[model samples]
Target: MNATHTTFAQDNGLRNIPAVDDFSGMINHPNPLIRESSPLLGFTVRVKTLLDPPEDKKLIDLIEQDIRHILLRLEAERYEPGILISWSYFFCTFIDEMVMARPWGIECWAQHTLLVRFHSETWGGEKCYQLINRLLLEPSRYHDLLEFIHLCLCLGFQGRYRMTAQYQEERERILRLIHQKLQSVRAQQPAERTALLSNTVIHVGSTERERRYRLHGLLSVKKIAWMMAFIALAGFLLFNWQLHIQTENIIDRLDVLLP
Candidate 1:
């Protein structure tokens, strides 16, 4: 959690932002508690970046292949495939590595290329690890934030992250732009509307097993009552049969004594 800030002006091809006073000083992995774990390196790989894409693709591809392979291996142990296939911020470091290491490396490349699309775009390099940690520290709807960040990275790279508002009032403005674009598109196109509505409905619908689970409890109550009633009736019939057998035995004994 150790951090120090130093300011920077745009020099060469670098963006106008702060730089780490000393990256090595800021990053302390040699702490007595820390281990030389590759997963930790994998975590570092997410926040770490190269100056350019072409030169770095080789390493990036290796990281992605590792992530994908691990994901597949984990999949066999899990009942749900989408859990590993989907997103979570806790694994952002791993995810970031996977994205960069993939064939397209679209997500990683976009973070470098598309950050300008958002209002609080900071190209803080590995220092971004601290920033992401800060933003996601508290308990909140983090999955949504991850989705938003993912969208920002992709859109920003495409140069679609535009300055639609005055400084400091920018994020809300971009959201409005997004909504407007979708609204207009939906209004103009029927196919898009149908697809959107269908997807929404499908998402809302309950799964068959969930429906069966809910119904099973109610069905069990009736079954228990029926079983209890049958047991009571059998007990009543057995009592009468035992009484009649005793009476017949007594009558035979009395006849034999009178004879």
Candidate 2:
């Protein structure tokens, strides 16, 4: 059987959908111009159609293009806040689809969305915050949640995005979840520990360990330096006392001889 036949069989007799690249070309076709009459509805139709088939090769690229198209329409329509919120929710659904279809590409799609749409000056923080909350609440979209938090951290560290109190709280909560997951994995499979530790979620914990190690080393060095200083002072005092005693004895001998 050919690759296409295998992909179709994987879908269990559902309509044989074209690959994402082919579908993307269809969406980008100039003829019927993705009807702006109801952009959200049209976009939803496209998303559902593409997701109907189980095979998701190049899915992330197609979603990125879809988001770009939506953003362009929003810009042309002059920032309708309501429509933008709808778009945010729509993208959140994409996270669920990604989690269900293929787990690995979720991170790439999430990072792309953050850098392209959420980080855009045109997109409001309120909308971004709402979307993030939605992702966090979903139990299965942990990868997306973690990647979003990571992107936020990267942006905040670069001074591109401000880290607000709410964002900080979210970060802490996600880190706690990650630590718990890491511990669970370690308890279950000792051999898998190394691989799990390499995940992005473990970064915060590793950084804390490194910081504590440096602090411990600094304290140890300070203690050693203090001991060395104390020993040097004592030796200097003892030497001075011994020299004084020898000088006094010589002076007494000189006096007696002169008499």
Candidate 3:
């Protein structure tokens, strides 16, 4: 293994970490099936294992380390686009699992968001955006729609390109669609309605975070303006106080001259 890979393995706890070097060696193995299946099977199994126990810190660290390594390899042209896509799906599956499990925590949500952004960058912006939009709008996949919306908002707010006007328009349209759907389902059944409302709340929270991110620059500007105003006021008060002292001194001098 290379120095970089060795460092990553060490950081993540090497006990169960997949040795990418071993897989690299198998690229030229005589058995065609082993050569073809080794990497994909190994990668899939490692990722799936990370999802078990759901709250395993070591597994989470290992998965994150692996994700960074994969992205680095992709950027360096060491991996094919197909391999990147497979990894993207694996990450998406993990997100879906989290969503299905009730009471999703912030750490898992953050990890999934990072994976989504990485996938978007590696898969090409337009393709990933389209995939997310399709998933968000699909009625059959409503259970996972909130996560998809969060992904879109993440892209719009933090992506290198930012979201275009067209993307923003589409996002608003989808939000409205979801709202309408939620309303229609409200009177049908209590359990279903409650679930949809919860998802909507989660989606709204993400949108609010995006809104805050967008406003960050404006907020900083306002803060600077307030500080400048405060300083100007303080300077004005100091000048007036000095002028008052000078006037009192002149009056005393005049009184002394009259005496």
Candidate 4:
């Protein structure tokens, strides 16, 4: 994180697209989950240069070893959540890069790697204290984590949540939950929390957040406008019902008189 990387564009967890020309920044961890993930450094270069059959085998093997080691430490709760998150982001980014580079045919290189383990199952479940701890307790950094999670989904880091109808439905459920959470938080701590958490728009596979400013913008409308709109809707329904009743009555009378 000490690495000075420029952020071109960002919204919530969506991070700046750091130029991968220099793999140094991506590899530098403040406190690496393991001793050194430096062996994984060759990833950026290989992804950029060559994705040959032999090279694919080596890349797959190295990433798998490092990930397995990290997952073991995670189970032991040996690393801090922040450090774990940094490594999680790195792993997610690795998958994103692989998707862009597409190494082995149509299937993603992630399923072949340990991305599924780190992203889902191995972390245990929703109750896991290691990663979800920071997420629940630290409201300030919620966007940061959510952004990376969204990025993973966007770039196809399918783990327990595969790229299917279920995957997208889960994504929406998370988005909806965050909106409700922020709304509650904002109401309770309007002054302090509003600026910290705000908006994240959705576009194909993007993590939706902040339901737009227009929801809060409702405060700007005139009371009379609301009253008029309500009255108009009521009046229309009332007239339609009255007209139907009148027609039914007339039809009955005509039938009776004819009979």
C-alpha lDDT of residue 40 in model 2: 25
For residue 35, model 3's alpha carbon misses the true position, in angstroms, by 38
lDDT of 4 by residue, 1-259 (tens): 2134222111122132333433343243222332233323323333443344332334444455555655455546455566455556556445445444455522545454444545552222232223433564654445434333432333333343433555556645554554445445444553433432322211123234322211131121357478889999999999999999999999999999998
Say which candidate scores most in TM-score: 4
How accurate locally, in lDDT, is each candidate?
Answer: 0.34, 0.39, 0.42, 0.43
| Model 2 lDDT, full chain set | 0.39
Tens-digit lDDT string for candidate 2 (182-223): 333333443422332232221212234222211011123457
Task: Report the lDDT of model 4 for residue 225.
Answer: 75
The deviation in Å at residue 113 for candidate 1 is 12
Clash pairs, candidate 2, are none
Estimate, for each residue in 106-213, the C-alpha lDDT of model 1 and write its tens digit.
Answer: 644555422232223433234333433443442132322332232333222111112232432343343344333433333344332223211111111022322221
* Candidate closer to the true structure by lDDT (higher is better), 1 or 3: 3
Worst 10 residues of 1 by lDDT: 197-206
Q: Write the per-residue lDDT of candidate 3 for residues 129-248, one digit (tens) a residue.
A: 455545445434332333333323432322212335546556555445544443444424344233333311211123553433221111234575898999999999999999999999
Off by over 4 Å in 3: 1-121, 136-138, 146-167, 182-193, 199-259
* Residue runs of model 1 more than 4 Å from their true location after superposition: 1-49, 52-57, 77-79, 88-259
Model 1, global lDDT: 0.34
